[model samples]
Target: MKLFYIKAALLNTMLLSFVDDGTILAQSKQLDDNNVGLYTYNPSLDLGYALHTGTSPLKPKTYWRYLGFYFDHRLTFHEHVRYYATKAFTTVQAIGASSIDCVVPIATYGYCLWYFNGARNKGAMNQLKWMQRKAALWIMGAFRTSPTGSLEALAGLIPVHLMLKKLATRAVYHVATLSDTHPLRSMMGEGLLKRAEPHARSAALMTPAMLGKVKSTVMEVDEHIHTLTESFKPFAPEARPGDRLLDRYADRLHFDKRNPPQDRHPYLDELIANARADPLTALAATNGSVPQSNQYQAASAAIIYKGHRELERTHYVSGRVTAPDAELNAITCAVHLAVKQANCQHIMVFTDSMGLAHKAVDPSVHSGQAFSLSVCRALQEWFEADDLRCITFIYVPSALRWDIHGEAHKYVTKLKVRVGRCKMDNSIDALRSQAAHSVLDSWSSTFQDPTYRGSEFLELQWPDGRPIQPSYLNGGPWLSTFRHSITEFTRVCQCITGHAPIGAYYHRFKINKPHSCTCGAAFQSHQHILFCCCDRYSVHYPHFLRDIALFMKYNPKAFGFNRDPSGVGSLLRVGLFLLLEDLSVN
Candidate 1:
């Protein structure tokens, strides 16, 4: 009974090993793409994956421990040695637990490959490798502390648990059950799902630098995200001033009965208006009755009614799958297809597959196949450009999907594939390929539909042309493309003039170009342009420069040759970085 309790504790605690509790790491809002693949964080996407690693009693005891426990279970020489091993492992893992990130191994692997620069030059790699090697030694050193070398068998087990829990959380369970009724359950969910993908590579062998970033960022939220709600309150109309939600966040939120932000509208009102445009009645009229079973929807009716192309970038994507390999190969294939040609910027892919996909893609499992994170690293490098940013990969819950679909179902289906003859006795190759079919609807871009028969254009170009990514753009780097476009015209305004562009330069510039500098110090030519630009007058120029750079990357026409000096309608805060430290008149 004591042995059973120990094993049981190891089982339950082992799975929790990967959970990161120190700080909640969240991705940027830029990742909410509901494009071609079923590639997202849907509750159903985890079904096939869940069966593989979501198994209860996730970690196994060492072979020696099993035998030792079976023979005598405790306090004997053999038992003490095992105890020593366990204690050493626990100490090593505890250090790793406090200092390491669970998702790091995969992230680093993929990241290193991305920056390999055609395998030509080496950057911080030697140092990073040294750190990793030392970390490995740190782990190995635990054994020296073990009085009996008999504890050696437990050498690596604790690190495994520490990493796993730091990676996945209880929330992952909900993601595991999205597609409970899908047909792929048998072969897709367990036993042999990743068996077919003979080339599915893991993210480790590809990039190491990228992985390091994931490790660092996985521990904390970004500063930009801290201000997200403050920047968006203008569009939300759900609550009234005196009513309450605003009161709770009185410090963080700045609205009141009479003093709402000048340009903001309520979210509830916007939703109501958007709802009007696509009343439930209208959707029923066009598409028969809408399926209540589907929980996913585009932006809410109210927001959609606003007639804007606003999209939520960071959101939970999910789907249900029962097919073998549907969880791993399908999403990975979609990422490959989407990014191989540069359809989007960068993409990060994560899995709890326990080397299943790693082995499938390379047949390296057991045969000494290692993870190759090349694809993911390439994506990261592409995102690092001034034009494109970074793409983060996250591993989420694939079971306990109860909170996902509105149905509130608790059980996640984790069936395994039965390798047997079917009606056609298709090869695993064919089955895996079929499993990788894109889950996109007609609107999808990357994952091609298995049911596609090709649609005819009315005249090849309608008045409103069919939305298609320009074929040329597909080959461009996604990170650069997104970076140049994201902040292009999105920022609020000129920090000085408060101008939102008009016909030609404002006449105020032509007439008001002062004979002497506005600061009354120097002549208003190049000298004034450099020395006298004050915080009150100089703030907007930097913002203009930033926006201009974004624009120039995409539309070179916007990169004007001339620089102008105009400072109006702005004040510098105490710590404006653009102002030289000496310029603060205060």
Candidate 2:
């Protein structure tokens, strides 16, 4: 593919090729005539090639389909959007929980070409939005009248426009990872590819970068991602087998989760006693904390002990540090201290975050790679010093609050240090996380506004009683509960959307029928029925989701259209009379 790109660069015409099939784009009419019998395609007219065998010419299309994207002479891409939108909508209907995978990529295929390039995409976006709305409705079994925003929230679908923005932003990041000698690199100015100084203004905005009037993906990435000095690592496939950083050093590092602490102080005492028994063993506990009140105020602390006495303790407070960054920093501090200790053979590291422990040894190009690389280098020397010198990382769940680990955790949590005035540089991962969080905040805000999600949309809360925010993480909060049963899921959806066949809903639609409950309430409502209505319809206010599920199970026809209020009332009276008669007989 690189060879093809290089070859195409030498030519004057625009060549868009995918594998064996491709299209040659040109504005010259005579070029086609000049080729004559050599080439069968007519550039002057829409004429397809005729096979050499006794066969008719293939039908000429107004637009060409190349690389799964449709394009006409004018580059409208209207047919492409329409075709894929319909295809994705149909595919979404049959797809289960993974409908997002099927629809999003299909609908937004080649978006960088048309959408991110800043084309007049109102029509295209509308088509894509329609596709997404249908998919959301189907996924949640939501009524047609349900607000698109709420349905999308419950269905775990990002809005179409935002999804495009996210994809385009990620594509920009990908371009940053490309080789310096790549063709796209030449189009981007040198400033974008250069590593940013620790505390300097962004090169993207400070210098006149691109000659083009429109902003390219490289410029966009530069605006968001600050390039690090160690950003330009060789691509993964370029490395030879067993030559990768992780492959060579992974054996020296160990992650031990066995013999986990069942309780707090007792288990912690045993661990400390075991370490004290071995005079040559060094024990280290590290913790990192990023408080919710202020994400920028991150702190990492590590405590080390040799024999029966504390060897050293260190903690650093930094601004704009992510949880992983802080965690890796703590690990790095612990590793550095442990390796420096005299006569240390076996080192035991206890951390609340086991994932970050593994990352401390990872060689991937990610946030906190600098810290990880430092720890790996230190451990490499420590292990090479003596054959038996090894380290084990043990998982200590923060909830356990083991004595040593808890101390480190507490220090970081309550550490007070003046943050430097100089602005901190965020890693690519941090920037991406910030962007995702911003998108979620926007979604939550939109859902909260009655004008957007409609007043009737049910606001659910997490088990902790915090209001549930929209997220694709773990299949969203609402649908994951009743997703096992389609019928139950549909009923829940209807109730939340206020599109169920209840009395209030009927009255709102002007059905010209009674809207009162069996208990003679003026009007039936979600809150009224769930709390104030008769026994069958009543449940506690701010009820547990489990209770809601049980309520639906016990009163199967509570929210269904099968029985009206009068019918339910008659059934209740008849059941009461039967109970009385049975009691008299007994």
Candidate 3:
């Protein structure tokens, strides 16, 4: 018996060494063990168990893990998925035994069954839809005590498909950044490029069947790029010489700007000619009527006429306005000047402001009754007098109108600075102030204690002053591998605000039988879940805390916990939220 134990120990040691040295094949061949397996999907192809090692053959396996990725010889992920699904189900059952009754939620059970039955058979989108449905049902069961309206209030959680898409997009970007001579590129060859190429085409060409086949990260990256390009096509110019080479991949295409010639529109030629003839006149002619009337001390108007080669002439008019309607006054002034000073019969009036343009053409439609009456009369008088045979109001987009409008804006800004005179009644400042207050009120409501001094949260505010909602903060790198469900993040928010459908909150509404936990805690609050729950301490609670520490270590600022000891509560709340999501089976 002693000799047999020693021999077994020696064999185990030798096997470990062989595995470390990547010589498992040699050891397996020497043993001639029929139990040695080679997993594969293709039964027709005979990959002899031990080719290099001179010994008896080893048996084949149907599935195995290689370099962190699950694989099967048949190239189908069915077996691989089933293995993981079983492991996950077991883990969930072990940890949640105390909380969930023997009868598992139908949704959770169905999700487990899917891994063995239909999950592998479906396409990516269909698979994602199945997971999403399961997720929604799981959330409903988890927060069963919450009101239906309250549950509905929570924004739909980021789906597993989207998380995968984001990761895949990032992976594509990483690959695209690699040098042309990188080893991975050579190994991938045309297979990688061919798979990604379909995503580079226009959306019209990307058929549903073709889209369904896009399962890999590379393909997802391509699809995102294609979608973005299509959205920006109107703003972005068509491809030019050398541009195609620059856009070898989706990432490259995102940053590739059109050549100078392509960005210049044909209308720009007329505007440029008009400007070059007389810079001052062109600036005045293109300027829009001021929006305000009552407070204006001085007003200015300009007009430009296009001729065969250059601008015929520019007309600039400046005067004081006693009238309350400044916009109407400016338009009347410009038209009278154009008819008197310009040579051309057909006149073109270019304006930077869309409001002014609308009022100039049809004042009765968009302007106030008082302003409309005056502006319409003036325009009709000019046309009847033959001051202008034809007048066209061309509305140039802001980017396209930069040269004309920008110059006018600069001139006006300088004049206002030098004269120290109040220009007009501008309501933009009042509107901006109102918007800022609204954002502040919304943010304040999120924190139970309004005095919580954490500048980190403030840093996440949008340019318009509205706080970036927690839903938008997809847990950076730490949470990247773990996709969260909608209810999970919402729970975090509820925890922080003390509004969750947990013990006391539900008990108060008569939804639950008791406010106290099984551990005899006075109230089963968010704090109890994180720190005081005795039932969860052994497995669920400890694991959750460890995940929180890991998350803080990975990205402290993402959850507004960085460099602030006071933010510990916020950090734990977010951590618990993430842990619940990580544990939940999609």
Candidate 4:
């Protein structure tokens, strides 16, 4: 009995060992499968082995779908593309069977292509283009419609290239932000300061020049980071009274009141009437009348005096209107003049130009415009003065109703008219002299006899009675379709530019021995390549005719092919494809 018990115990020990080994093996296999799905530099060798051996617990044929993106054991999206293609076709068929608009299916497929796979891989992009082409063809066939101009237009979708570019730009902007916890920041080793410190010890072992290069690199990285941070920093509201008033004016202009304001203000009509009745007297009266302290003025003054004493506030500025560059000069001049005339801490100058007003408020925008460097220098001088607390630019409506703005506008307009007259007189004199000599010799001159018509002696003339000129060589129907390979597209462009690699051009450059075609044509020019009905070129002849037919249907006058069939050869020479079916023949 004791011997029997010993044998049972031995069997039990072996059984327990087998169970533990199996469990460990299964857990390891699971780990390998999990690693295959991860976006790691190196995946598990065990997973690859399983894939090759076909012994993987998770089948090799099975695809793994995670986080909306699909992949197989090899991390390829081939199966994902196949699945979407089928889905798109079925959706389109269903939409066709129903009463839904045909545009719905196109839109649905486009949305799927963009959002479903996020266009994360080249395979996805290819699949998107293929599906779009198929969908467009299917829709046109179902609806009995002619082929649309371009692929995107036919599908009623944004171009795939543009969409991808937009997404890429957004990703780059996100990666460039200056957050420590950002994924890109971590990927780049937490930026220059941290990256440089770790390599400092290693730098001492290098040559002096190499060490200097390393130091310079570190400094460049630091400066780059600083620039990016400054560029992306959120703009704060300008503290000046002028900017605040401008913001208020902008808001009022875009206001959505229930009782909408009239298109024309009553005060404008009254001002117009006053001006018409007595121009000189009205102008004098308007200039003399001080603008009543309205809500805009009161609000501006209140904000300016918030931190200063009542006794310190002295000067009150209104507004001005002038030319584009003159406006900037006027603002600067007005601010200085106000400060000099009345010793004041704050001065506001309202202008009729939004562009100038924005430049004054935003330093970055100001720096990029023409003549900004000089303006900045002037501003720097004013800012340095201890008494000048702030110089601001506010926007005001350029209307005759506004008395101050009207007066400024009158003076500026008169000055501009005077300058314009002087420039115009000089320009007219110069243009008149050039015009006399610039007339073409072909142009009909009064010196020529009335009956000495040279064109009547010429043998060639347009059948439509329209005068044929050198300008016709440059005119043709605009090609609305460009869905061809780069090589073919380039050939089309060359043909249009009159520099195609035809027999004649190649012979001129010594690429070919003769400029003749095998059909015994004189010169294998663009006209011969398009119009020659030789046995070798007969296959493409129908396609050329079809293109011409389509061109005539849409644009008759553009090519004038209907008036003269001979001009069809010229039409074909100007970038229109000779063989529409076979793009490879280009």
Candidate 5:
């Protein structure tokens, strides 16, 4: 087998070889015909050599394809974007609308390498945009003249530019969560010491000068990068497959779902009494709270006892945190106290939020890892001390106001510590929530504009009359409502876009058809059908999708021209009318 590994320090040349392909990048002080050199490797001699003596220099190409990415001499990536976009568009045309999802990723593959804001790459972006718009049109079955924004919104697709931005942002944040020893973290100019000493920075493989010369995605990461060395603790034993928290401790995690919160206090009190009566067991109750006045401020308190005698009471307050962070810390402190007990073999922890208790013992890389790691370390020691040593985590709802938990809850709630400003890092969950709110704000700004929504677009609202807002979460709010029924889903889309085959749409498009409703109302528009149509027994238009879905289910032919040949719709109406008449007669 032939093997190639070439590296030249003086000329600054490197080669990265994949299974079937390789990429070589070389640097020079100045570009000249005489200054070019060919880089070669000799496996037999274990040496790298620049063959410039009595040999013609290698010619530089205008573009090259490596590992499925096209690199242009000018770094424009125009050919790459055009190729994929055209390919996706063609594939979308050949496949059913449901398969549009398979083609979107094809057009945006490896986009992190080429996409950035204001790169003067509008041609490339336009190609991808046109491809997405094509798929959106097919998915929604909307006209070519329909507003691109409305069509993509109804199709549950983000705009091309915003999608690119979202992907780029997510990629940056993902790197931020990587372990300190990760190569990507090192390449992004961070170090292991950076988390401990926030001022410390690392010299990366790419120098500042080299970074400036390239259109790099790392440069676009901007302030999103952070040192998460403390968060990722892969060395913990709980992370192992057979020794995971649930694997070794599933039986210890107790939950009481059969009893209501009101009735749980008595059972919980009996368990506490049994624990305190045993000299070998310890009992603890923990509580955490986040004040509404200052969301970042959090407090946790725990009460530990043995043999019906109070042993330790621990409490702490932190800033720039979430409720989970506080709850996890409370569990951590309680376990730490329990582990220090002289001869205790069993420990019991009562928490209001069992979800947080499960999270505390979990060794996964998540929001409150700093607390979770501490909890895991302490519990591992406690569990390994003796075979009989075991812990039980019980659930006691805070609203139940059980004596033990209520005391801790009251203490944590009255914490007077206020943080005007601090340098503490926000928890991962808090940061993610903040970023989501920012993206929602951007969407609202664009969607609330009348011109952007188009003049004929039908606006929707919640039951309370607040204007409906768009979100990409959970398949967006609109699709999540009527996704179970194809007919109802299509009707809602048609209503929102005003692109149905109704009299108003036909008249506006100058199509040769009757522009009057069958009931003699002029222009069978959405407003007329929703409010004034006599055949449908017009009522106030619904503000919620649930109400809309029910209305469409009752009047199946309201939006479409199809009539039930079996007369199921007629039977449903007659049954409802007879029921109404019987109530009146009674």
Candidate 6:
């Protein structure tokens, strides 16, 4: 039994001696490469597994490495040689026969040194915990058996390993004065310090030049830590300094620069790396793409009302307003429209009407503060969200007719008419509301099937310039039809909106002027273009693509059309219609 225990101890010793302390990584070809991985920022265990595939859940298990029996790796091929000769000679004692000590000194010496080396390696401060496990196995073997020098040798490494482990705690590590760093920070956290090396203390005290790469990371981590926790107090005591540090960092609220109870997983740094690479900041830098300029009006979705009378015309305005005591009303009008329709009460209204939006919400932030041209330009922007929209004023560009105000000569009078006490048109807002209603109606268009489909009716033209009526979709020649739909849409707007022309960003076909329709007694705008001027009785003119998608899958990229579909009016209509349909159907 004594001989068997010594033999097992010898086997373990030999295994340990074969492994080089830092070079035992199963995944890495080069031991010195610090390219373990990008530092993960989240405190998770997966980061270690990322460095080496097939890492065992039972990690901290040691692999054997000897200086002589090396694994040689070429650029293309790798080779390893493991030396395992059964015995120097056939000996009964070595074969576990309680006969005699027949094994040679060289083999015995080699085996003893291997186990002793492992025991010593484990006892090092950086790996003291692991070393204890190693030392225990050998010491127990030595005592359980009569006497084995190998087991005795292992116990020798324990006291020193414990002392150095204690020494490691005494160092005052300065984090941010140096560079960007995450892994070192990870190590200071609890549970994930997988690195086991005798030289860990030396590595921690790197030269300034060496830290240049990582120093910035440490500072960044500090900034992030400070920012994340600004709203909340520190949850742990050692995690932060006294109330003074907390007070100083109160407003900043990021990473808390305090130690966790123990070293933790290094994978968290990986998450940080990924977050930094995202491009949202760059996107926000541009603000948002400028929306189409227009007199935005309407509420509960803008409406387009077309009179089936002669002299087709349309107008733009929000809901009816209670007469304001101050400033020309057109200036505050858009702001009022924006608040009620778009739900933007905190409107930054700018108009010649001294203080309109401000008074409507708060007079302090009103139209009077802005210049004249500022007001006109501000109101011209298309209706979007409140955060991205604004209202401006004009001294009523025209009443019933074009009236030039201010300095008589400042306006190059191409054609000027007189001002009158006429009722301002709120038709644009009405049309938008009607358009929303039309979409809702489409949802109810089909009861049995409940599947109402719309197609883009297009204007077709050949290379020789013969205008053609759009054919129903047959998988090809969509360009002519799409152009026709846009043309009809623009023309309908002219009929419904009174001479307002809608333009495209990029298209396969040129937009055609819409033929005037005898709808109402007012001018036309965007409200008339989509749902108003079209057949309001039969409801045949489908204004949105979700309608088209109902018939066939709508492809914004169909038929050589190469433009982002976001800004397209048709696409917006589709999304709105689809949502309405869903709500009604459900």
The candidate scoring highest on TM-score is 2
Backbone clashes for every candidate come to 86, 0, 11, 0, 0, 86
Which wins on TM-score, candidate 1 or candidate 6? 1
Quick one: how many clashes does candidate 5 have?
A: 0
The digit string of per-residue lDDT tens for model 5 on 1-586 reads 1343323533344334456543344444433312232234332321222233323345666777777888887778888998898888788778844455677688888787678754777878888878788876665555676777776666666677777776676566566556555555544554333333232233345567865665567665544555222255645666778877567766654554545445786787787788778899888889888777753477888889887688999777866567777888898899898899899988888887778877887887777776887787787766767778788778887787887788788878777577765455566666555566677677778877767666667666544445667776655666655556544455556666766666887898999988888678877775565445665432222223354447556555332212323344432332222121111101
Better of 3 and 6 by TM-score: 3
lDDT of 4 at 132: 54
Instruction: Give TM per candidate.
Output: 0.16, 0.77, 0.32, 0.30, 0.73, 0.16
lDDT of each: 0.26, 0.65, 0.39, 0.37, 0.65, 0.27
Q: Estimate candidate 2's RMSD in Å.
A: 8.5
Q: Candidate 2: lDDT of 386?
A: 90
For candidate 1, the 10 contiguous residues with the lowest summed lDDT are 281-290
Residue 265 miss distance in model 6 (angstroms) = 52
The sequence of per-residue lDDT tens digits that candidate 2 reaches over residues 462-494 is 333456677866667666655665555566666
**1 versus 6: better lDDT goes to:** 6
User: How does model 2 fare in lDDT?
Assistant: 0.65
- The lowest-lDDT stretch of 10 consecutive residues in candidate 3 is 227-236
Q: How far is each candidate from the true structure, as Cα RMSD in Å?
A: 30.8, 8.5, 22.6, 20.0, 8.7, 33.4
Q: What are the per-residue Cα lDDT tens digits for candidate 4 across 176-207?
A: 33333433233232343232333423432456
Clashing residue pairs, backbone N/CA/C < 3 A, model 4: none
Q: lDDT, candidate 2, residue 581?
A: 13
lDDT per residue (tens digit) for residues 1-586 in model 1: 4553454343212111113342111122221211111122223544424423344332322222222232232212333233433444345356642233342443233222212213321332333333333443343332121211111111211222222222232112212222333332222222212223212222222245643444221112121112111111111222234432223222321111223233323432343245335322110000001112323211100001112222111111122222222333333333343343323433323222323333323221111111123223333344334244232222222332211111111111211123333222222222222222321121133212222211111011112333221121222121123333322211211111112121111232354433443455444332233334463236434544443444435644221111221211111221122222221111
| Clash count, candidate 1 | 86
- Compose the digit string of candidate 3's lDDT tens values, residues 392-467: 4444443564554444434432332122363323222222333344433443354323333121112223233344
TM-score for candidate 4, please give it. 0.30
Q: Could you tell me which 10 consecutive residues in candidate 2 have the lowest summed lDDT?
A: 577-586
